[model samples]
Target chain A: MRILEYIALMAVPAVVLFAGVVMLFGGKNYFESFIKGAKEGFATAVGLLPTLVALLAAISMLRASGAIEFISSVLKEPLSALGIPSEIIPLLLTRPFSGSASSALFSDLIGNIGPDSFASLCAAVIMGSSDTVVYIISIYFSSVNIKKTRYAFPLAFVVMLFCIFFSCFICRIWFK
Target chain B: MLGKIFGIICIVSVFFGIACGNTGQLGSAVIDGASSAVTLTLALLGMMCLWSGILNVLKEAGAIKKLTVLMTPILKFFFPDAYKSGVGSEEIAANVAANLLGVGNAATPLALSAMKKLQLQNPTPEIASRDMITLAVLNTSSVSLIPSTVITLLRSSGSENPFDIIIPIWITSFTCAAMALILCRALGSATRVRTIRSKDYKSLKTQARQ
Candidate 1:
């Protein structure tokens, strides 16, 4: 476990070091290439601002209007019956759409139920395994200007549910 | 697609807000949400730019090319059409490699570039091609070698062993990625088969008329 943590900590710096060494020996101005890419990244982020605002606004509206909470409460009984811990239900509900919101729910869950509990493990696994489906779909498709996403949204949603379930199932078995 | 979903969300939320009599909260959420989005973007800008810069250097140094070559066989399985045309395979490979390292900020720009390249090869400009959908699904069910952020959060929350969940995360992520690939391949072929059957039906009708 300690070794795994060490490797995880080193991965980023190792990649940067490798890039630096290669750039140095390759006889090109690394700063120039970096600045060029950084400029593109800045432009990309700026371009995505409107999309983020639109998506986040709708999500926040859902939260503020008590829609997500209502849905979560309704599902609590059924999901808990299926062996899912109630503590992680809110996290699962928000995770497919919003990263930050889910993170907040996750920490709150750990705080409420203790960090070493089964539900917290499940939340951690879910966090590590899945990406924000709606956010990724909207950003990626809009970036390419594709209006007709065909089956992507439905398919991604289905996959997100599967991942959530799988996360809970694995954590249940492995943590025990 | 996003339009319909966004519309539904807005309408449903507004109605719910009215029913719950939290119009004031909803109004505040409207403003707060927009500001939060801007704040989040600004917060991410530095990290995104830094990784993009590093990736640029890697690309120029030919390191990305090596990763592309190594990734081609596996990527080819998931993206046969793109591989056959040789359109956006390199960018796709780079994107997947960055994602495997759990460097999402670096992966996003590569993914956007790959999408552009794939768009050029798309027969229908407004519709997502099979390769494009596959790429998006791949991103959603991303396979990561190390999920550092999750571990950090767990550690900060005072877990006895924050890394204990690593293996479970690995298993879950790999299973999701495999399932995503299978689903996309199945869905892609199902649509293609339907189109072909319809085409055949039209051809038969034309033959009979002639």
Candidate 2:
């Protein structure tokens, strides 16, 4: 199983390289296009700089302001009643805003509480399954100048709720 | 300006708390956390730029286009309305494929391009059509196969197996996608019923006019 996993991991880069080669042959201007694309990609990366800073700063503020603690306290009773650990609440709440920040929190949980713990595993799973809905809305929609996202928020929230419930249930049933 | 304001506020807040000596350790922790956050933000921005560059190269090489074609049928089922225009299907498929691969940083441009094509087909942009809403719904709940960024974090955090949660994650993702689809369809049916009722009233009015 480990060998297969390694092979799968290796396959992605191989496929990408193969695709690149295929493109090189598909057109006379393949090299030019590739260079142009790379430039555009780099430009996009530079453009995302401010949003990334803002996200990190906001995360910092939230943590510094004791907002996370306050939130955890408020959610403690309800989440614990649902069989989730208090530790997982921060990940569940923050994962949809800043993926890196949530991951940092996840790392802290794993380091402090141990990765083998059910809470860590559940947090990891929830982070993977859920999309960063708020980030997506702020970035994608705003970039496209989309003023009204009629169904977007509702759909994202519903899916997130379902994933959280289902993930918690599965973790309890299988890992427990 | 906002960043500077936030930085100042954070510093001031820390000093105020420290001067009061209300909670020395907490004040220190807050300052330390904020400074670390600035560093991490800088690092994340750098990483995003690198990934965006790679994605752009891949896209220009036509890998994205080919991948979109390969995924079109599946994408069609997910976003049926995207194909209303001639080549809109390919653009939507490409955008979605990029998004699912956790390449949303790269997918942003493709999505914008597709949205432009879609807008051209629409007569009125004031109200979203059923198809447009469906596209938005699917995009919002787009299933992820590999949680790349999460796995990276787990690996850095010393997980024995960063990808250990893959199976559970996939299961949860599919469940969410399934539910999103069902809800969209139910909502769509109600809209259809309303449309039919309105169409009937319009026909009756036409008959009265005649």
Q: Name the best candidate (by TM-score).
A: 2
List model 1 lDDT by residue over A1-176, tens digit each: 56765665576678779777867777878879989887877786677678767766776787789776677688879987777776676577567776666655565457557879988898898898898898898899999899989889999888888888888898778767
Q: Estimate each model's TM-score.
A: 0.68, 0.71
CAPRI quality of model 2: acceptable
How well does candidate 2 reproduce the true complex, by DockQ?
0.35
> On residues A24-95, what C-alpha lDDT tens digit does candidate 2 reach at each position?
676665556545655655575455445444444444444555555556787889888877777787677666
- TM-score of the B chain in model 2? 0.67
Q: Which stretches of candidate 1 lie over 4 Å from their true place?
A: A1-74, B1-64, B193-210
Q: Is the docking of candidate 1 incorrect, acceptable, medium or high quality?
A: acceptable
Query: Scoring each candidate complex against the real one, what DockQ results?
Result: 0.47, 0.35
Fraction of native Cα-Cα interface contacts (under 8 Å, chains A and B) also present in model 1? 0.69
